[model samples]
Structures are given as structure tokens and as C-alpha cells.
Target: MNEKLTKEEIMAALNERHSPEKQALLSEGRVAIAGLGGLGSNVAYALARIGVGHLHLIDFDVVDITNLNRQQYFMEHLGMYKTDALKSLLLKINPYLDIQTDCVKVTEENIVDLLGDEPIICEAFDRPEAKAMLVNGVLEHFPEKKLVSATGMAGYGSSNTIRTKRLMKNFYLCGDGVTEPEYGNGLMAPRVAICAAHEANMITRLILGEEEI
Candidate 1:
């Protein structure tokens, strides 16, 4: 007779594909994401699947029809706050993950508080201004924390241009590093997810004390 799988067994099976050392590192790492749109949603999902134990998701926006294109959300999540909806999805991926959501806008005055003391920060905002604000705020106020941000993930083709660069001590930027959203190029799933993957991978590397790519 086949044995029934317990919750622990299921979790072990889910994580059996990863090396024990990497899995242990991920389970002890905590990261805070500054946005919950295309980049943030995908970053959180990737980290959760990889067994990141704690995630702090900050977003004040609600799910809209337009976000269905590339966001890690479903139509059923429409009208729901991004943080709440994202938390629901992430938990389903790893039920043991500690996901904390803040449904509030991140501003210069409150960015530090919103992000908390998480050692890693993921800047996944769609707007240039918001991204800059978070990066600047972290660099100036929380220099001890490592930050990963992205730029120019818009448009299609030339996906190879999307690269992760170590900007400064404890700081990294991903994407083509030039394609601003206003270039009349539309944002699609392929490139956006590519950039998010870069950010997520960098975070994983940082957690494992691996050299920057």
C-alpha cells in the first residue's frame, strides 16, 4: 500500500530538488520588496518557491485589469489589494513562508519603516521616481542593507541585453539598464520577468554569500 504524505513530507518533496545548503540558506533569509506589480510579484513568487522564509511585501495599489498581462496574479484577485493578493499566492507556494504585507504607499518619510530591518531589499517599482526614491532612501538611511533594483525591462526582443550589474557596495541593478518606459516601447511578460529573475537570482546569491554576477 502507498503511504499518505504528511505536510512535512510534501514540503520535503517540494524542496528535494534543491541542494540542502542552498535550501537552508533560503529558509533563513528575509527580503523586503518595495512594489507588487510585474517585477515585485514575480520576484516574491520566485523567492517563495526557492524557500525564502520571510517576505515583506509593500504596496498600496489594488489589482487592475491591466496588471493581468504579466503580474503574478489571477483575474479572481481583481479589486483586491496587491499586497494581500500577492501574500495569498505566495503562501500557496510555500505554506510555511512568513509573509507580511503593508498596504500603504512608500514615501521618502516612511520608506525605511515600510521596509523594516530586512537585510535584503528588492526595488521592483514600475515608475522611475519610485525606484529612485527607494534606492536613494536605502543607500542614505539603511546603508547596511543590500539593495537590488531594476531598470529598462520594457519592450520585447534583445532579451540578452538584460544583465545584472553590481552598482556599488551592497547595491545592484538589473535589466537592460537603458530602456525607460517612455520610449514608446510597451512592457511585455518576457522581458519584465527576465529582469525580475535577475533581481531574484541576485538576492539568492547574496543570501548564499555568492559573488555578484
Candidate 2:
């Protein structure tokens, strides 16, 4: 990074060709992600690494020992809020990055407000009902915001099967939507990471305006 460049400026200049207008563009970009679980946690980490200027992460659930299997929270962070745990670690990775953390469950009533500011929305909720609520809420109140949702990724599967599908304009979903926790035989690390990567990849493309969704 250039000595004179601000964190934002350095990131902008560093990825100038792929990210135009320097910090100016990043300054205008913000992403809201619901759920800080196996999917959400990895998604946020990837976005932070990519130098997104701002992020709003939400999750009311507290970290547990089970989460260490696939989620980003550590053993030391047990009992910590997932949103708080993620925020604590993410900021350390990029102090210049702006993060707004909300330790609250995402329901239809609040999903709109929680997601209102960001141009892109990332759906990382593990439960089908909660994920559906967020998706429906977005479609109802904020129709234009780009969305990346993940589903059916519970079972042990090869990483290659996890892929991003452009469902429609501004809407992208990852994974085959086939696996379930009951039949998952159990969730493992690799599947979680693969699905998360697909979601994060779509998010980055949307942010850069490289893809419609």
C-alpha cells in the first residue's frame, strides 16, 4: 500500500482496475448480511478480505461449541453473540472497514429495516423458515436490493457441487437445495466453506457491478 493512501484509498488503488473510482466507490458501498452462522460467518469474512468499505451483520444467536465445527466463532468465543464475535474478529482484519453489528433475530417485521441501507443483502440463515422470511421481506419492501441466499447444504457433499445460481435479476442462490440437516449424516467443514464461497463470490460480483446479480 502507498504510504499516503488511506485504508480505503489503498484498497481502491490496489484493486483499481477491478474496482474503479478508488475509495470513492467503496465509500458508497454497503452490504447487509442476515445470520452469522456457518454460512454468514464465512461470507462476512470473505467480503472483509475483499475490502468492502462497509458491512451490516445481524444475528441474535449466541455462539456455541457446535458452531466450531463449521461456523467462524472460536472455542474461546462460546457464549458470545455471533454478530459480536464476527465483528470483533473482522475489525481486527481491517480496522479501516466500517461494520455495524446487530444482535437481533431477523423477522419479517425487522428484516426490512435491518436490510434497508445496504445495496446488497446476503442470506445466511440456516433455518428454512427464517431464510424464507428474509427473502419474502426483501421482495416485499426492498425489491431492488441484490440478494444472495444459500440453502440445502447440510449433508456431507463434494465441494464442487456447491455452486451459485443466478435465479433472476438481482437474485442469486447457492447450493443444490437438496441436502437437509436430518439426512446430512452430519454437517462438516468443507461443505460449509464451499457454499459460503459461492455466496461470497456472487456478492463481490454484485458489488463491483460486474454481474447483474
Candidate 3:
């Protein structure tokens, strides 16, 4: 006799596709996104829909009028912490998502605490120095974990240039790496989102134990 799939069954089957292992690593995949701006916002939202269960959000900035251009923040979220605002939107998409917010500036001191047990980390810091600081600290602290950071997703040109490159073992870098607008650069929404998507995809693949995809 043939049996029908229930809601839980249907979702479980779909979840299995993300990671065949029990308690799907992807579904239980804990991740820490270190920025909550243009790239980070969309990345977090995309990961939530893709079945990422736990997320640790770290951001120290509030919504600004200038951020409305390409950032995910909307007019209604003005004056709100980016992490708080993103958490609200992410919860709306998937209430089951474990969204933990950290409205602190990541530094050498609090990085260890800010980052829980997430196996993968995404860097969305726009400022080069800030990004490097986090990257160095994480690498020094946890050499085994995977870290993906964006480099040069500025200016409005070809979307094709936005790509990902593996810098080393358990480390990947995404973005144009240059070709940004000269002084006072502007970033396009599509390009930023594309890069973030690649980073999220890499994180998913790593969690799945996929072979060097």
C-alpha cells in the first residue's frame, strides 16, 4: 500500500536534500555573520530560507538614511540596530530560525564570546581594516573553521565579475577584488547579493561534507 506524506514528512524530505545526514547539519547548521550591512543582510535572509537553523548575528551599526540605497534595511527600520532589524525580517520568513543578535562591535576581546560554536563564519564588513581584524582573530583562534570574506563588490558594472575564490584551506574570498568606483564608490544591489549568495552556498556545501565543490 502506498502512503501519503504528511507536513512533517514533506519538510523532512526537503530538509534531507540539504544534508542527507540525520538532524541535517544544514538544518542545525549554526552560523555567525559578522556584519549586517548590504551583503550581510541578504546573506542572512537567504541562509534562513535555505534551511540554516541557527544564526548568530553581530553588528554594531544602526539603520541610516544613506543605507536605504542598497542595504536591506527599509524606511520603517530607521534608527534600529542592523542586527535587530535583520532578525525581525528573518523571523518573519521562518519563525523557526534561531536568530541571536549581538549589537556589539567585534574586537579581539569579545570575538570569542560573540562567536559561539558555528562552524562557518561570513565576513560582510565594508571597511577593510575591520574585516581584516575579525578575519585574523578568527583564524588565530579557530584555525579549523571555515571563513568567507568579501573583498571588492563596489561600483556598478558587470555582474559577472562578482565571483568567489578559495584563498586557502577552509578559507574563501568573494567579490570583484577591485573595479570599484573611484572615490565615493557606489555598490549595486544585484552584485552585492550575488556575492553574498556565493558565500552562503559555500557555507552550505561545507556543512554538507560535499567534496570540494
- Top TM-score prediction, candidate number: 1
What's the CA error at residue 148 for candidate 2, in Å? 0.6
RMSD after CA superposition, every candidate: 2.4, 3.1, 4.5
User: What lDDT tens digits, residue by residue, belong to model 2 across residues 1-213?
Assistant: 434446765565547644455435545668898989899899999888767879999999999998899998888899988888999898777778899999888876777678888889999988888888888888778888888899877777766777788887777889977887874466677788889998888887776677753
Put the candidates in TM-score order, highest first: 1, 2, 3
The deviation in Å at residue 86 for candidate 2 is: 0.7
lDDT of 3 at 126: 80
Q: Write the per-residue lDDT of candidate 1 for residues 1-213, one digit (tens) a residue.
A: 355446476468656877677678888899999899999999999999888888999999999999999999999999999999999888776667889888999999898678766999999999998888889999999998999999998888698999999889899999988887656577888899999999999999999898557
Global lDDT of each candidate: 0.89, 0.82, 0.81
Q: Please give the lDDT score for candidate 2.
A: 0.82
List the candidate numbers ranked by lDDT, top first: 1, 2, 3
